[model samples]
Target: MTTIQPTHRRGATRLTDAGRDIATMLWRDTIRTARQPEMLVFAVVMGVFFLVLFNYVFGGAIGAGAEVDYLQFLVPGVFVITALQGAQQSSMGLATDLAEGVTDRFRSLPMSQVAVIAGRTLADAFRNLVGLALVALLALVMGYRFDSATGAVAAILLATAVGFGFSWLGAAIAAKVRQPDMVGMLSMFWLFPLMLASTAFAPADSMPGWLQPFATYQPISVASDAVRGLCDGALDTGDLVLAVGWTVGLLAVFAPLSIRIYTETD
Candidate 1:
């Protein structure tokens, strides 16, 4: 009689194998990102555009009205927006790969299937880190100061975490649609409403009363508030808690959903 592996041992082995596969996929994606330097340029350029435009064009009016240093308020919000852009890229990139049949090649390999999307999200996250750092440097040049080096690091990490969660949502969309153009449109469908309606570009109080509740409590607003607090050295526990909750909620819902959709896709 042939001996069978124990169930616990088999489970442990699969987990270990999955971890290795994820790492391998991560390396592969990272190398691909390096080869395509324009991807990085696009991410950084968008962040810079927001930084300059808001700081110059609307900064005077918003700053005067809010009675706060506009650049300081704007930078943290831009950090969150830049991170969201990375998530958007994650959606587009995966959709493009699917449209081009790269995932078909991945499916033929004897590896963890989920690693494909997992690795892409992780790679995009690293890209977000670099993009956020570049944005921060530019903010420094423009006279935006962080409360402390530690706070700055924390703020960036928080933004990246939120972005990572959203990437899973993007991945789910791509897996379901399997079309780059549609995925891009779908991403903007969700992204722009949250971005524009939230407190990222302006304070919640500036908005009409009916819109204030949604504007103040939405993910982007809470994220911006938490990040801004870190930058300003006036941390608000409520904002931080809400921001973390949103990230966790996003991952809990979308991570498995994306993996399921990818596996089920033709």
Candidate 2:
């Protein structure tokens, strides 16, 4: 007699298989990242560039005008910015793989296809953690101090979460475009505007009235504010909630969308 397997048992089996596939893919990506150390170096260099340029060139004016230590204000924002740069790398890396026919090989395997993008994002998240740590250490050397060890940890974790969400967004773009150059250009379209227009480098109140609303409430601004509060030991519930909401919103919209686009791509 033909008998159907139990639905719950089948579901559990699928979940286990997916987990294994994701873990395998993650290991593959970690090895790839290690073989190519330049990727990590580039992320860290950009973070340091921003740290030095803003802290030295414009720090005095911004600090005096806002009545706040600019380094304190700037480090948290740089953390968020550094994390976002990791997202851009995910996009470019995935797009490069797609262009190079790597994903085609992946498609031929008997594995959960979503794991391909999922693993890359997770690997990039790890890279982001290391990059943020390096930036934080440099900030400490440059006279920035966290209010507490707990706050510093929380701030970095939150920034990494924000980056993970954005990495999914980047994956969606890469899966759809499948060209590294186009993906890089498209990334700039979203990244620079959100970055420069936000309160990352200065107070939103300093911007023109027309820009204040957006500069104050955008995802980057909310994330910067949340991380800043954490570092300062003055965590604001509203900023934290908004930052989390944005991250969750990005994941909800992009994770499935990227998976679908990837599977549908020729």
Best by lDDT: 2
Give the deviation of candidate 2 from the true structure as CA RMSD.
Answer: 2.8
**Residue 203, candidate 2: alpha-carbon lDDT:** 86
Q: For residues 1-266, could you state the per-residue lDDT of candidate 2 as single tens digits?
A: 99876656577788999999999999999999989889999999999999999999999877874667889989999999999999999999999877776778989987899899999999999999999999999999999999999999999999999999999999999999989999999999999988999988988988999999999999999999999999999999999999999999999999999999999944
| Residue 247's lDDT in candidate 2 | 100
Model 1: per-residue Cα lDDT over 180-204, one tens digit each: 8999888989999888898889999
Per-residue lDDT for 198 in model 2? 94
Q: Candidate 1 — which pairs collide? A: none
TM-score result, candidate 2: 0.95
